[model samples]
Target: MRIARMHLNESPFKPSRLVSSHVSKYVDKLNLYHVEELEAEFLKKLSSYTKLPRESISLYPGSSEALIALVRFCRSRALKLVSIWPSFHGFVEFANMEGVGVDFVYLTPESFELDLAKLTAVGSRSKALYLANPNNPTSNILFQDKDTLDFLSSRFGLVIVDEAYFEFSGYTAADGVLDYDNLVVVRTFSKAFSLAGARVGYVLTNQELSEEIGRYTALFSVSTTSLASALGALEDIDYMMEIVKKVIELREELKRDVEKLGLYALNSKTNFLFIKTPTLGRVLARSLSEKGIKIRAYNDRLIENYIRVSVSSREDNLRFTEALAALLRERSTVG
Candidate 1:
């Protein structure tokens, strides 16, 4: 049986044809280091796309690199990383590796909503706040109101908002970057733009913060090919929008289908769904893997019964639902 790879929240569709064509032009020039002109052009296009000043933007190989640089910068200033519990695990791991202290304000269980009171209580202890809008694992937008985001921005010394799934969520903190000098937004082409392999991510913030974070990143870290891919993606925004629309539709369909099987599916704003499984997540994940389907399961105590699966094409989604149904039937029979 063919494997249905739905663990990682990757775009099911291939990138726009323009991305391939643009990368091809860089093949012969790989022998030479990428020129400043290439970087300048990429920034110009990105600035136009994001509607932010070019000075406010900085490029990196991936958003993870940009995030790590921010973590190191926070560490230098003796700031602890504060975030909601069960967020993107990689960011917390990065902080631990850098010896930066970390703190978490747990979301309300089941609903997974942010508790403002708990968050405020930690303000005195934490100077740096990292939030993944439409949070990972839970796949729900934590702060939907502008007032709350503004309050958090004012409370923290630095606030980094990861908008990796912005295309699907239709929300962004990038617009507030100039309004709040402490606000920083990170975006990537990996999901909606379908450029995971290209490794292009960028930061949006005030010019000063942008430059400071850029200092931590090495020079010319993004390859010429990746720049070309990002440029092409910007040129073909409509294609990316089309892909986002389809993924959102499929995500909703999958959510409904899973709910029909008597499982709880979190209302997701990203390309993946966070499902509350009837059985332990590990057992469900193992069973699904046996049927050539792969998904994400958490070992974190609070979310041990949850599984995350990326929205794929209709056929793959059907396969997932069918396998899940069979497992549920077997479990019911055994019970």
Candidate 2:
């Protein structure tokens, strides 16, 4: 049995003409500067979108590196980290490598929202909390309310919100950073900005803490190409929003389509949608792969028989339908 991995939806669109023509041409042609100035400019532009003070920003190679740096900082202090489950798998790994204690609060599959009561016991002992606002894999969204945010801020020493999918959701706790000294919001260009290869990400916190993170982070963590691309990406804010708008529309359409297939979609505000299929997940994945379509499949004990498919354009969606439909029919014939 051969298996293959596929990316559902990538940056659907190519890099803008402005990025190719204006900002990057000079550097790619001949002149190149260190990423410091580029990072500074990009962060300055990012400040306009986020409410946090610009000086509170730390640029990184990407969200993955930034996360590792965070783990290092918490490890140095030997603080316990508590995170909700059904998150990016790296949370568990980060805790283990740093030798920091970890606590998990698994949300029920039905609501897929945090259990506030269950978390009350956690923050007091929690030195740092990691969360994905519109969580990955399961794609459950939370904190459209105040009580949970207030409870977290009051008790936890640090509450980190990974809003990598915020561009699609139009929601954030980055503004909460203004009110709560303990809040840190992490964002990336990979998702919405279509700059995944650019390896650009930034953290929003107070200036003092930002400096501390910078001290621990790689000095030239950002690449000159990434810095220029990010600046160019930010330059066309309307185009970014247009891409987000299309993805949101496609995500809803995908949810409806999945439901029609006797599968349920976890409410998603990301570029990807999680679909539940009782026993056909692996089968469907294999079938799709043989047909040249790719997506992520998940079969954990808690979340058995499901796959995450990125919300692509109409053509790809139709191709998925064609492949999956054939697979289902073949299974019926075999049975």
TM-score of each: 0.97, 0.91
Residue 292 local lDDT, model 1: 95
Instruction: Report the lDDT tens digits of candidate 1 across residue range 59-101.
Output: 9999999998999889877777898887999899888887776
RMSD of each: 1.2, 2.8
lDDT of 2 by residue, 35-151 (tens): 455666777888887855678778898887787788777676666687887777776776677666677888766667887777776667347888898887777677766667788
Index of the highest-lDDT prediction = 1
Candidate 1 vs. truth: CA RMSD? 1.2
* Model 2 ranges off by over 4 Å: 1-9, 22-37, 97-101
What CA RMSD would candidate 2 show?
Answer: 2.8
How many steric clashes does model 1 contain? 0
Scanning candidate 1 in windows of ten residues, the lowest lDDT window is 118-127
- TM-score winner: 1
Task: List, in order, the clash count of every candidate structure.
Answer: 0, 0
Clashing pairs in 1: none
